[model samples]
Target chain A: MKFIVSIKMVPDVYAPFQIKDGELLMDGDRTVLNAYDASAVEEALVLTEKHGGDVEVVCIGSAKASETIRKALAMGAAKGYHIQTNGDETYDSSSYAQILASFLSDKEYDILSFGKQSQDTDSGLTGGMVAQLLNLPYATNAVGLEIEDNKLVVKRQGDSGQEMIELPTPCLVTCSNDMNEPRIPNLKGIMASKRKPVESLSVSDLGVDATALEAVSKVTSYEPVPARAAGKKFEGEPEEIAREVAQLLDTEANVL
Target chain B: MSTLLTYVAISDGKIKRSSLEVLSHCKSIADAGGMACEAVIIDENATSYTDDVQKYGASKIYTVEGDAFKQHQNGSLLKALTKVNEVAQPSLIAFASTEGTKDVLGALAAQLKAGVVADVSSFNFDGTKVTAQRPMMAAKIMGNVNVTGNPVLVSVRSGSYDLKENPATAEVVSVDVTVESGDLRATLREIISATGDTIDLNEAEAIVAAGRGVKDEEAKALISELASVLNAGIGASRALTESGVYDPSLQIGQTGKVVSPQLYIAVGISGAIQHTAGMANSKVIVAINKDADAPIFEIADYGIVGDLYKILPTFIEEIKKIKN
Candidate 1:
């Protein structure tokens, strides 16, 4: 069995985001592997380790994405693949799905995995779109996964509870963060990652017409949410503070 | 053929409030465009929610009833939606942003060859194209997006729009959309419920959340007591949830659940940017921490500079006295 996992590097959720000249300033912002995508990579690596196969990490981004792919490689992925994008162009979920489906068509894989969502946009669309594009059996928000008798069994989080699902080998799953605790890349793993090969491909190389990859939606503006002003503060004894806080919430905040 | 359609999701045999909100929004968009507002419901008893959706201004309800929809499989759902599309030919489709419908909307977008504007917080119509404002970069930067083509699909974030009462008569029409046996590529095995019968974090009106400052294991019970007293959901920051101090389902942060509760009480949380991003949208925020300079105070409407352990007990006592 061979596994292919789609990963993304997003702005660190803990860092402050800034807008410059009416655009999201990504160049200077700190980047980290999407937390959910890291869980996806962990799930894929676990499955591959159990089933005697190799896991390959893929992403669609600028040159900086190589670091993200390398992070996955350090976490035990066999290799990494980067689909270089033309800078300054934002692609929607549909275009990204189309490109990934086209790329996977020529390759053979038993399973495809993706993060449940990206923290940046939180669209949670790519994996399902790709599954639809490929017409494959798919599941999302999987908290549990197992491979048995050439079938993929998964437990996914739903509205009310977790639903267990069983699909065929050639299936796709979007892993929720709870699927597993992502392993940190150790010093030896980082050293080994330096020796591992990372392959790169442009849209043209993947046979996708660069001009045809137009975004379905265009961001007309980017701005920060207005900051809330600091209000009254209560100090001193716990009793005094608690009473003041409660009174303020009930009278002024109107939320009690 | 130009229609504004909203997909009404059924949970536990009822139309969710978030779905009704989406329907209300869709109706407004339809009114603006001079189009009809319709709703598509897929359930064993699809017509059951006709009155509910109609109350939210849906002029017509499309029903697709079958055991295939009893357990929501994306393949079966797409087929039913495709059938509805063939009949209605909606120019625009909308869905409520939820864990239950996100993947379905994604698959539907690919099947219909339509572009999707997902998790939109607000919408603006300039008599032609609908521009949606959505949060990007973890609610730090807002992205104003324009959905250009026909049959554009969007998922409105929960609580983004109010559910308006438009009181109208909606015709219930059943569509003959059956799932072929061969199309069943996935099979439901079982369902596992999460622990604790507390209110869901996303659905809670008020939340009592704990952060890393609650050092001891016994503090969880203290927070739980406070939550019960306030009739609020119990939530925790990633530091607590990831460290096995609390259930992961109750984690509220950037990588966790994003909530817009009417009231939020943070105990012992030195608000990281990630945690703040999730709860900043709450109507009123109160932070109780030992550190006077905890970042949570930046957005908190009320701040208590003291140990949460001592403060929380007194706070609960005060609230109980007021209630009594």
Candidate 2:
């Protein structure tokens, strides 16, 4: 079995972001592979270890994304593939999906995996678009998977419970945040990653014509959210507070 | 100018509150354009919801009823809407931005080879052009999206539009259709039940949520008070519910319930992605936290940097006065 997983490098949610007000701020201390995509990397490792096959990680970003490719190599990916771009422009979901779809259209890979959503886009739109473009089976929020009769038996997340979905070998699965625990890389693996194969590709090389795709809306600016108004704590008997609460609910919210 | 509006309906055997909110939003857009607004529903039987559909201001109800149409079958829905657009030739298509609706429509747009204006807070028209407001960069920035296409795809963020019953009589029109092989091929195997009350969080417009920062005694009081005041349901963070500070049924996050309400109030929350993933689609977010640096502040439209204990009583009084 051959597996291909998509990975992305994102800012640490805890650290104040690097790009604020459409201007450059110094990059912060920590940057990691996306949480869901990390699970995709780990799942590939687990499956490769059990089935004895090749696992590769792919990403579309600036040269800075190599930081995560190195992480994936340390986590046991056999090779790293990066398609570098010189611009800071962020493509909308449809355009990004088209670029990736074109990249994978001719590749004869058996399994394709990606994170369910990306925080920067929080739109949860890419993975499914790739599958639709490829005309292959697609599933989201796959928590578990197993190989049986040359098909993939998977567990998908629903609003409240789990659902089991089955698809053939050439299928796409998007990993949810809770899919699996991510593996930590040790010093030995970190040192060994430099020796692994890393290939660089470009949008021009892939025949990507980005000019045809237009942006309907642009994120012109960002501001720190305003603070909330003060809340008043009521101290009294539970029943008394409850009655006042009821009055407040009716008068203010018009709920009662 | 033209406008597109989308309504989300919660179906078990019928349409729900979220559905009307979507319609009211479209009514606003249509009123601006001086055009007819149509409400579309996907269900097994169309007539079950006729009276309420028009009572809620939908001048017309377009329903595709049958087994294939139930619970948002993405493939069939995409096909059905394509036919509807071909027939109606409307200026815009609107959606109510439900969880499944967002996912399904996002995919549908890619399938239809169209761009989507997602989670619009509000929209305006000027006889020939339409402009709508959207939140990006995780709700910190408010941006305007202009639609130039003849028929654009737009979805209203949950709780963004207030619902009203205009009560104009309208008739229901049904479309006959079939499910396709490509449609049934995706992974929508089943709909599982959440922990307790089986309450549909997606249908709620007002949500009151509490977190671990809520000092113990105040934790329980917060829910009861907020729910009573807002006529809203209660929700809690996984941390608080796991430590027995609250019931698990109230837990909201990546592993719990995902809700999109009109007014989302966070009490004592630190605003981790786990919790934000559940309610980031809200129309208005207000956070009350003592820690000014809490991540919840990153997404809050209004954040009160004070002890909730010192804040809730007075705030509630102020709200009462404002409304009165």
Candidate 3:
């Protein structure tokens, strides 16, 4: 039951929206694994620990992705593969998944996992796209999963509730936040992670043609939403206040 | 450009306002190119909503009927959706952003080999090309995406678009799909409704949210006070929700509810991207934090850089006077 979990280090969501003409803007400081992907990693770790298998993490991005690799290792992954020296922050999920599928074709891993969606882009496309590329059985927002006789059984969340699914062993699942609680990094685990073996392979070295990718971008502008006008306060009975609010919604705001 | 239609709903069978907003966005997309708007409804009773769908401007609807179809189960839904795709061959697909929507949509996209753009706030048309705007650094840096495939897919964040009820009537077409009883693969068991006096944040017209900057639990009493005076729902950031003082439903952020009330008031929240991405779309965003440097100010329509504990009461008093 070998496993591969993809992890991404996303910018802190607490930062301000940066919409300038020339330079990119976002929080520059702290880096945490995208929340949903964290559940994916934790699920992979839990699966490997239960099934008696070594787990490897495959991270595709610039050197910044190395932090993702280190975090995966610290979380008890046996090792990690860094697809390094590459990545534009805006790479389309199709290209990213394509690059990884090509890499996975030459490798052997039973199961694949990733965040249901990235916090940065909120595109849960990477895992699904990779699974499509590989032509494997895939599930997303899997809340319940189990292994039986080399096949996989999972419960995926739907709009109203949940669904049960059974597929062969070779598949991919994008875990959501409630999949599992991500373990906190301990001092010992962090220290031991340094000793773990990590192999960094560049896209060019891995037989990937760097120039074949498309360069696409969207945001021509980013700006803060306009402020609201001052509120008109009211002091009266609850029913009276409701009447005033109704009037405001009907007259001044005309939103009622 | 290919047009995709996303359906938005809340607990039980209520049509969420967010879904209406997503429909508005879909309208904008259809107008961008020659894209036609079609909706995929999984609710148990779709016939009752045809008038409502028309009000949202949908030209056609692919209604899936069944008790099983009522609740969203990713696997069964993926299979059912696969069946629908095989039939309708819609050029694009879309869904409202939700935990359940994200899950089934990911599987649907992968199993169908479609492209995905999740949590998009805005999108523009370039002739036949569709460019979408999504949050990159939480909501700090916006990223653009161009979908090249025929069946481009997207999930609209809650409340990002202005909802409009179009006048045209929509055609409801029922579709039959096979979903085996054994095929029920996931279990939601139950939805432990959150306990609180506050209205559901997702459904609220106005929200007054609090954060950790409130020195103690006693401070939440003030949040309730303000909410009561304004006839608004109460909300809390993830920090406060996780702090065990509030129910999970009250939590507002990327991991929680994405609220877009007409008026959003924040107390002690320091505008983190995780937090802002949830409430940035509010019609009027107001933040009050002692620290003037709080990032919340960036998105806030109004900011009073003063202690929330002191200002909230005074502000409520001021509003009370104005109302009288």
Candidate 4:
């Protein structure tokens, strides 16, 4: 089964940053492939590797996104499609979903995949939005995926339990990072990625009205999360401190 | 008057308290803004929850009942929500963020052409727009978001607002929905439920989370005993869950469940930012780890430097004594 996975380039959440006067100030330009998308790419690669098929990735980002696409190519994806955008546009989940939907409108694929949510934003709306816009069957927060009887079986983590769902071909799924540990690209794979093909296109080239892609929801500002003040730390004999803290929970904290 | 509709979520034969919390908040907003407060419950036994839902001050209750609504299917849910939105014509639709809501929120928004914000910790609707604050960059920072549309959609994280009871006499309105077989693109095979009577960590008042230090069955038993003593839910760090020591449903971290319980006890957890991102909002945090300098201590209201094997037994015994 051929798979087309939608990937994203996000700011590295691990990078050191500061918020001042409602503005987030990062230390440097540290960007990486979204962790959840990396898992989606990895899962698609694994499935296509087992069954004889090709795994392709489509990404929506600025010029810097080619590095991210190469990272995926280095991990064994057969091809990449970069939907280039000006970095300054304030695009929300809906905008990205519309762009991806327009790009994938006439594309042929058995399964369309995406990360459940971006690591930085965590909005988790784009995948479902794209599925809806494309009128495709979809599932989200998938922890396990398997191909059986020409169908995609998804084990999605729900509120009550893990639900096993089966969808026919031409379906969509948003993968959770719990699915698998993404493999790092080796030296040989990196060398091969340099020779891989990456097709770059503008939003207008996809026949989408760029003016209609206005984001209804936008982040107005950033602020530091109020720090939780640390209380007293007791270090002494295990039994003594344990009993004392338990009493404190009852009398002082009133939680017990 | 414009309506503010709250989607009351049902899980495991019970209405989610978080949904009631959202309703309570919406009711207050409606009252202050001079708008009508309403609610929608889409379930197999939707009408059964009407009385309980009325306690939160929904003047009108919309119920969409059928066997197709028995389980969480995004197709049926999106259709039901769309129908309800058409009937109610709500200016703002609110939801208590759940896995079910997350599965369908974006699709519903896209279908309705409505602006949406998900997993917001706090939000308010002004006359013209809805503004919300949510954790970004893995809870390392907060982002204020503004959403604009005819009917703005917002999902609130559990524990973001306190539950305030304001009873109202609600008029029950049954919504007609038909889910043909063709509409269901995905079929649920089965559910691998967690073992019996495991409290939901999202709604738990207190949580006892095991980390890497909880290695053996003995430590697991101790953690269980402590949780039982305090009537708290049992959770696990990503290390324990990924290592197959605990169920994935019990995993508490950025990639897992983001919880803000009344009390959170971290046993044997050397709190990484990823883990703390989920539980940092707990009202009271207690960290018990042998490593005195564990980052958990930085945010824990009470930090005890000790081993779990020794500390847990004494701690559980003392808590049991205190409860008695």
Candidate 5:
């Protein structure tokens, strides 16, 4: 079995961000691999460990994305594929899906995995759209998985409850944090990653269709979210605080 | 501009509130363009919901009734929706940001060769363009998106749009479709129930959340008691969920579920940015923490500087007394 995990580099959510000239200025912010993508990489490594195969990590970003891929390599990926793009290109889910689908169409891989949602965009659409483009069965928000014969059994999060389902091989799975704990890279693994193989490709190299590359949605402007106003504060005995809160809920919130 | 179509999600023989909210949102977009707005419902009891959806301002309702919808067969549902789209010729299609609708909308967008905006908080339209305000970077930054596709698709975040009762007489249209078993690539095996009520955090009216300050599993009872007194849902910060003190389903953070309840009370929570991102859009927020400078207090509408263990029980008692 062969696995491909797609990862994205995102700014730390806790870091303060600014909007300048109608665009988000990521300047001075540290960028790291998306936290959820770590679970996808870990799930792929575990699958490879059990089934005796190699795991390849793929990412779509600028040249710096190789560093993000290197982190996955240090964790245990055998190779890395970076789809090189400029830093400012705005590709919506459809265009991103088209790029991944076009690249993976000619490649021979058993399973393609992604994080359930990206920390930056939180679109949660790429994996499913890729599956649709490739006309393959896919599962979203997978928390558990097991390979049985030629089928993959998965536990997925649903609206009302958790759903256990089965799909054939060559399927796409978007892994959530509940899947497994991602392992941190040790000194030995970091040293080994320096010698690992990494490849880069462009849209022209893959012969991607021009129509597929057209972005239908673009960010028109960016703004910092308005901070909530500081409201009434109560500091007193527990009973007094409770009474005040109860009164506030009744008068202001109307939830009492 | 052409018509707007909204997918109304139904479960357990009734329409979900999130879907009605989206339908109302779609109606506003349609009215802005001087076009029609319709709703598509795939369920066993689609016709039973015609009057309910009409009350929310759907001018036309397409109900595709079958057993396949009982378990959310996305492939079949997409096929039915496509058939309706071909007839309706909608320029914009909307779905609520629920698990099933998101799944279907993703594939449906690919099949229709349309552009998509997911989990939009708000949207505006001129004569020619639709601009969407999306909470990006874990709700830390807001991005104004301009959609320029021939047909646009969007999934609206729950609680982002207020539900307004704009009554309209709806013309019910029945869509007959056949579901081939062979077309299904996957099947729902079983739905394992999680602890507590089935109300998802995204749809909860009120939420009482706990954090690492609660210390132990036994301390969670205080939070639950407060939630019960307020008739709210129970949630937990990522720290408690990651520590295995609570189920991940109850987790609220950047990596977990984003929620927008009418009233959100954070007990024993330090208000990490990631956790606040999940509930910052809530209507009214209240925080109870021992530390006066906790970040949660910055966004809280009401703040109490006290120990939650001491504050929660008395708060619950006071709320109960007031309610009675």
Candidate 6:
């Protein structure tokens, strides 16, 4: 069993940022492995380690993304494929999916995985798009993964419940961050990661039509979410305030 | 005239109210733009939902029914949606953002070669282009997006719009789509339904969410009692879910289900940004925690600083009294 998990380096959503003139401003250097992708990589590594296989990672970003790939390598991924981009192009989920599809078109692997959605945009589109392009059996929002008798069984979070799905080889899955906690790189693993092989390629190198990679959707501006004003606070006897608020819910708030 | 098609989602044998909300918005858009408003219901009992869909003003309804459509299998759903798209030739397709929609939205858009925007809070589709506002960076910021395609696709978040009734005489059309077993590359082995009869959090009018401070079975019982009184869905923060105190299906946060019920009650939960991101859109928020400065209080419409053990019993009793 061979695993190729698509990884990404995304803006640290926790970093303080500002919106001015409909533009989002944040520290460009503050980037990290997407948490959901890290979970995908972690799950793949766990499965391959127990099942006597190897885990590899693929990422699409600028040269700085090699650091992200290295982080996965430190988590014991055997190899990395860096699909280099200009880092300035306003690529949407579709563009990234096309690039990944083109790169994986000629590759061999048993399972393909991705984060359920990007940390920054949270569009959650690319994995299914790539799966469609490659015509593979796929599942999304996977909270758990298991390999059984040459099949990938996924426990995916659905609207109503957790659906246990089984996909044959050459399948795709998008992992949710709820799956598992990603392992931090140990000192020895970090040193080994520095020596791990990282194969780099440009989008043009994949033979995908440049026009097809053009973004069909563009983010025109960024705006702050409407703030919810804090309301009345009640700090008194438990029974008194509790009854008071309950009355307010029915009378004042009209919700009850 | 071009058509605006809304996909009516069915979950647990009932049509999702969020889907009707999306249909209502699309109907208004179609009425204002002089375009045809249509709907597609793909379910085991798709035709049974036509009357309910008609109430939302869809002039034409497409039904793709079969046992294959019983559970959400992306392969069968994609095939059915493709056939409907071909028959409807809609200029824009709208959906209520659900886990099912998230599973197949990308693949459907890719198959159709259409532009797509996912989990948008609000969207507008003119004759040519579609513009949408979607939450980004864990709902801390909103991104205004412009989409271009012959048939643009968009999925709106639940509670983004109010449901409106605009009755119409709908022409029902049955779409024929046979999904061979060979085409279903993935097989559903089983479904682990954690919340069997509990109200779905996404559709609940009110939610009672337990956090770390809800430690013991006693507290859990109190939480359940409170929910029972208010008819609210039970939810949990990641802490409770990860610790196995609550089912993962009931976890509400950035990495879990995002909910916007009319009323949200947080019990013993210190409000983290990740948890707050999911429920910040609730119409009225009430947080009860011993910590006076808990961040959940920042956005809570009614912040009660008290111990859950003491507060919940009184809260439940008071609500029950009000109801009687």
Full candidate order by DockQ, most accurate first:
6, 4, 5, 1, 2, 3
Tell me the TM-score of each prediction against the true structure: 0.92, 0.80, 0.77, 0.99, 0.96, 0.99
Model 1 chain A: worst 10 consecutive residues (lDDT sum): A20-29
lDDT of 4 by residue, B213-320 (tens): 999999999999999998999999999988889998888988889889989999999999999999999999999999988999999999999888989899998999
Give the TM-score (vs. native) of candidate 6.
Answer: 0.99
Which 10 consecutive residues of model 4 chain B have the lowest summed lDDT?
A: B194-203
Question: Candidate 2 lDDT, tens digit per residue, A119-201?
Answer: 44455667877887887776676767776666776776543345567777798888775556889998888989999998999
User: What's the CA error at residue A174 for candidate 2, in Å?
Assistant: 2.7
What would the per-residue lDDT of candidate 2 be over residues B2-99, giving only the tens digit for each residue? 43434436456656676677787677768766877777766677667777788877776777777776655456666677666655556767776554
Residue-wise C-alpha lDDT for candidate 1, range A30-143, written one tens digit per residue: 789998989988988888789878899889888888889999999999888899886457788778888998888887888999998898788889999999889899998887
TM-score of chain A of 6: 0.98
Report the candidate with higher DockQ, 1 versus 6: 6
Q: lDDT of each model, Cα atoms only? A: 0.83, 0.68, 0.69, 0.93, 0.83, 0.94
The candidate maximizing DockQ is 6
Q: Positional deviation of A101 in candidate 2, in angstroms?
A: 0.3
Candidate 3 per-residue lDDT over residues B1-324, each given as its tens digit: 354655545346677666777777777777666777777676678667667767777887777777776665555676667877776676666667776666656556656766566777776554345578776655555565676454666777767777777766677778886677545433344443445344656667889898888667568888888788778888888787766676655778776667788888888898776787788878877677777677787776566666565566666765666556
lDDT of 5 at B103: 69
**Interface RMSD, every prediction, one decimal place:** 1.8, 6.2, 6.7, 0.8, 1.5, 0.7
- Angstrom error of the Cα, residue B235, model 6: value is 0.7
DockQ values per model: 0.69, 0.30, 0.22, 0.88, 0.74, 0.91
Residues A1-256 of candidate 3 have per-residue lDDT tens digits of 8888887777766555455773556665566778887787788778767877778888876778788888878888888888875455456666677678888887887888878777766666677667756767677767666776776667665433345666676788877676568898788889989999888887667675665344332444554434434444433343444344444544565323
Worst 10 residues of 5 chain B by lDDT: B193-202
Q: Candidate 1: misplaced stretches above 4 Å?
A: A11-17, A28-31, B126-128, B195-197, B214-218
* Tens-digit lDDT string for candidate 1 (B104-135): 87888888887678888887554346799888
